[model samples]
Target: MRTPLTAGALLALALAAQPALAKGPATSPNEAATARHYASLIAGSQPNMAELTLFFTQMPKGGDLHHHYSGAIYVEQYVDFVDRQGYCVNKQTYRIETDKALVAAERAKPAAERNCLSSAEIYADDHTWRELLQRWSNKDFFNHGALQPPPDRLFFQTFGYFGPVSNSNFKEGLQELKKRAIAENVSYIETMFKLSPAVANPDFDAKAWQNANDDAAFDAQMRAWFAVLDKDPAFNKTIADFVARIVDSSEGIDDERFTMRYQTYVLRLLNPSLVFSSMVSGFKAAKSSDKIVGVNIVGQESTNISMRDYALHMKMFRFLKSVYPDVKVALHAGELAMGDVPPEGLKFHIDQALTVAGANRIGHGLDLAHETNATGIMQTMREKDIPVEINLTSNAFINGVEGSHHPINLYRKYGVPYVISTDDAGVTRHTLSNEYVLFASRYKPSYAEMKKTSYNSIRYAFLPVAEKQRLTRQLDQRFADFEAKIARLAKTAAKAP
Candidate 1:
C-alpha cells in the first residue's frame, strides 16, 4: 500500500488544488504561500491567538464602512479637548462639566468635597482617570466586578459623556483617525459623521403618524413636505452649512495611500417631523458634496421611539430615495438581539431595510435568523449583491452576539456578501486588526475569503465608480505587499532552528 500522506502534505495539496476557493479570481503565488502559513497559524482546535493577532494586525483592511465619527474618538483624546477648552470633569459623575457657575460652586467647596476637577486634576487623581476610561469605553467592563449597566446601555451612554466635545475638534479628530487607520493598513473609511439639521412641524407629525402604516399616503404626504422644505430658507441654509462643515472638516484627510468619506445620519430617537425632515436634509447634504457619499439612520434601535418608528424610518428612506435616486443609503437594521426587543420586533428590520428602504448595504444585521422569511431575505441580498457590515466586537459588547452565534456563518453559508468592520473602534477600545483576529480565530475562513472580505469593504463602499476603482487598485498593491511579507516570514520560520 502507498504510504499515507502527512497532515502537512495534505494541507499543501489542498492549498494548491483550491487556490481560487473564494469568490474572486485565482490567487497569486505569494497569496497562496500566505494562505499556507495562515492555515498553519489557525489550523488546530485552539488556534494561535497571538500569531493570529500579529498576522491580522499587519494585514491590509480595505476600509471601515460602518464607522461612527464621535464614537471613533478615544476618551483620552476627548480629555485633551477638555483641557484645551478649559472644561472641568465632574468627579462624582465622571462627566465633562462646562457650566461656569457649577464649576465655580464646586471650586468653592473644600478640596475633599469638590466634585468638579479640571483635566490636570483628573490626571493627578489616578482613580478618577481610571474611572473615566472605564466609563468612556468598554475598558475594564467585563474584567472587573463593578456596579454597571447593561452592555448595550453602557455602550450608548458613552456618547452622552463625550457629546459636548465631539464636534468641537473636528479637524483634529479626523487627523487622529487618519493616523490610526494608516498604522493599521486600513485604506479607506466611510464614517457616519453627524446628524443633519431637523425642524419640527406638529401639523406634519400628526398627519404622518396617522398615515405611518400606509405607504402610498405617506409617500404623497412626504412629497408635499419636501416641497415645503425646498422653499424653507432656514432649512436650506442648514443643509448648506452641514455640507460646508463636512468639506471644511475633511480637508487634508485624504491622500494617495488613504481615503475618507462622510455619511450624514438622522437620529431615530426624534419626533416624526424632526426625523423625516432630518432625513431630507441628510439626502440633500449627500447630493450637495461628493465627499458626503451617503445618508444613514443611527440610534439605539431598541429604544422606545426607535422601535415605534422603525417602519416609518424605513419608509422615510424609501421616499427620500425616490427624490434623490443617486444618493446611497446604508441602514443600521437588525441591530437588536432577542431580549432587547419583543420577538415580533426582530422579524422585519433587515427585510424592510432592503425591500422598502432599498438600502445599498445593511449594518449590524444580527437578527438575520430571526427575521421573517429569513432564507428569502438572504436570497434577496445575494441576488441583489447587497453586503452586510459585520461588527464582531460591537455585536459582542453590545448584544452579546459572537462565536458561532453570530449570523456571519449563515451569511457565508448562503453566499450572501459580507464585510468585517469596526463599528465604533474608539468606544469599544479595539482596532480593525483585533476585529480581524476575532473573525479569523472564531470562523477559520480561508485566506482567500478574508482577502475577499477586505475587497468587499471597498467594493460595497458608497463611492463613485472612479474613486472605488482607485481604492481597489491601491488595495491590490497593499495586499500584494502584505502577502509577500507574510510569505517571507513563513520562509524565515522554516529555516529557523
Candidate 2:
C-alpha cells in the first residue's frame, strides 16, 4: 500500500483531484432548474417523446435558417390559394390545371370522369383530399401501401404540383409562415423564397466549359461575362425588379419581435450559362436590397447537369464572391447519400462549398463523413466557426439518414457547430418543435447545448451584426420566461403524487 505509485495511478489521482469541467455556460437558477427537469425526462432508456414535445414546444427557438418559402407553406394553405386563384387540379396527375379551355373541357365530363376538380370539390371528397395531401406532402407516405416513387423524387416533385400557386399570394403565405413561427417561439426565418431570372448563352456556356478547371482562365471568362451583363439594361432591370418584388413581398414581415429575410436562389440543374447568369442576378438582387440577405444554389444535387458542372458552379460562386464579397451564401451542399450518387460525388461537395464557394453556412451537410479528409473538413469548419444546418425530419424522409448513421454524431464528436432546423416543415409535415423533439430524443443533448443551438441559429444567420445582437437579446428574455414556466411546472409535478 505504501509502495511508489505507478505513473498512470499518480496521473489519475491528480486529475481526479481537479473539478469537473462545466458542460456549458453558467446558468441562472431557473435555467438550472429547467435543465435538471429536462435531463430527467431524457435519462431513461426510451425518452418520452410526448413530454419532450411539450417541453420543446414551449422552448424558444431563436430562428429557422434553412427554410424554403414554398416548402414551408402547408398543403392546406396552397389548396386554399388554388381556390382563390380559380385554378383546378388535374385529379389524375395532381397537377394544377391552369389552362381555361382545358379546365372547362375537363369539367364538362360526367362526375365520375371529370378529372379537373376545383379546390372545394377536392376537399369535399375525403379520398381525394387525403390523396392530395399525400401527394403534396409526406402525409401517409410511410403509413400507407401506396405506389410510391423514390422518397427523394416524391419529395422534390411536390413543388411542381404547387408551383403554380406558390408564387401567388406571397403576402398571405409569408404571413402564414410568420404566424406559425411565432406560435412556436421562433423569432426569425431566412427562407429561400424564389429563383432569380436567368438567361442562356451558348457562347458563354462554351467559354465557361472550356475553362472550367483552369482558375485563371475561368476567372477571366467570368469577368468578361460580367462585363457584358453589366451593360445589358434588360438584365440590370430584371435584378432591380427582382429586388423590388422581394421588398414589396416582405411588407409587414418584420416587427419588433419577429423578423424574416429572403434568399434569392439559383437552380443548379440549369445549363452553365443559365446557372451563372442566375447566380449573377441573385448576387445583384442581394446587393440591391437589404431584405434579400443572401444568395443560394438549390436543386437536386444528383442531377446530371448539377453533378457534371458542380465544380464550375463552385468556381462561379468563388468568382462572384470575389466581386461581391459582402453578399452571403448558404449552399445546399452534401444533401446526398451513398446510393444517391457515385461514391466520388460525395467526397468533395461539402469541402468545395466551404473552400471554393465561400458558403458562410451549409444546409444539409449530410455527407460530411463521406468527404475526403473528412476530419480535416470538420476541423476547418470548427476553426472557422461555420455551422451546418441539421434537418432531422427532412434527412430522415429523403435520405434515410438518421439516428447513429447521421453525420450529426460525427459533427458533435469533432466539435463542429450545428443548428437544428425544419428544412421544409410543411413538406415534411413537422414543425420546429417537432425537430427539437427529434433532436432531444435521439441525441439527448443537454439543455445548455440545446440553448446554445438556439443561439447558433441567430449567430450564423445572414444578418448584420446589430440585427443578430437584437435578436439575441430578445431570445434571452424569451428563454428566461420559458424556463421560469418550466421551473414552475417542475415544482408542481414534484408536489403531485
Across 1-497, the per-residue lDDT of candidate 1 in tens digits comes to 12334557544544543443365533687888899999998898999999999999999999999999999998889988886766789988999988878877977888788788877778889999989988899889978877889899899999999888897889999999999999999999999998999999999889888998788899899999999998999899989988998899999999988899999999999989999999999999998899999999999999999999888998889888988999999999999898999999999899899988999999989999898767667767866889999999999999999898899987777667889999999999999999999999999998888888899999999988899999999888988999999999999999999
lDDT by candidate, in order shown: 0.89, 0.89
RMSD of each: 6.8, 5.9
Residue 63 local lDDT, model 2: 96
30-149 in candidate 2: lDDT tens per residue? 999999999988998899888899999999999999999999999999998987887899887888988888877877888788888988889988988988988899899888988988
Candidate 2 colliding pairs, count: 0
Estimate the TM-score of every prediction.
0.94, 0.94
lDDT of 1 at 102: 82
